[model samples]
Target: MLSPFDAHIDAELAQAVATIAHLRRALEETSTPGEAEEVLDLFEKLLRDLERVKPTVIGRTRQHGASWDAVGRSIGMNKDAARKKYNTNNVQRALARIQDGRPATPHPQRAPVHP
Candidate 1:
């Protein structure tokens, strides 16, 4: 059975795919430079949004007990590449927060240490 997180990811990816298809059709049907530019801008924004969500999705998947190999397969990468890209201290902390039943926001900055 798919987890709730998996279902959410599926829904998001489906929406993104549909939006991209619509943008592609719009781009193809554009009669004026301004319309094409608008479509391009929307596409850029969608790309940015996907980039922002990718790490969070990966972190959540890892938190749900997925292995790096599984993540890599899902994303069309190798295990080492997936680990190198998504395995960061921030991601780890976020996963920790999720496991701890807290919101997965960034931890506050620490004060400098003195010798």
Candidate 2:
């Protein structure tokens, strides 16, 4: 079953693909260079939007109990690479919370000690 976040990502990707296809058709049909340029600019903007969302999606996937290895595999990377790239911001945020005297969210639970 797809998680809600996963489903959302899938939907967004589908929409982006549709938009890209429309833009491609528009580009092919354009009679003027200016129109083609406009379509290309739209494509660039769409790419930028996708780039901006990537880290947020990765972070949220981790929060949703995805392992670094899983994330890496999904993105065609290795576990260490994924963690190094995506975990830095999370670490910085946690440090900021600690500095401000607020406990970081989703604190790890310790196992009970038994005699």
RMSD of each: 11.0, 16.9
lDDT of each: 0.71, 0.68
Q: Candidate 2: where are CA atoms >4 Å away? A: 1-29, 88-115
Clashes of 1: 0
lDDT of 2 by residue, 14-48 (tens): 76888788788888888876666667666765675
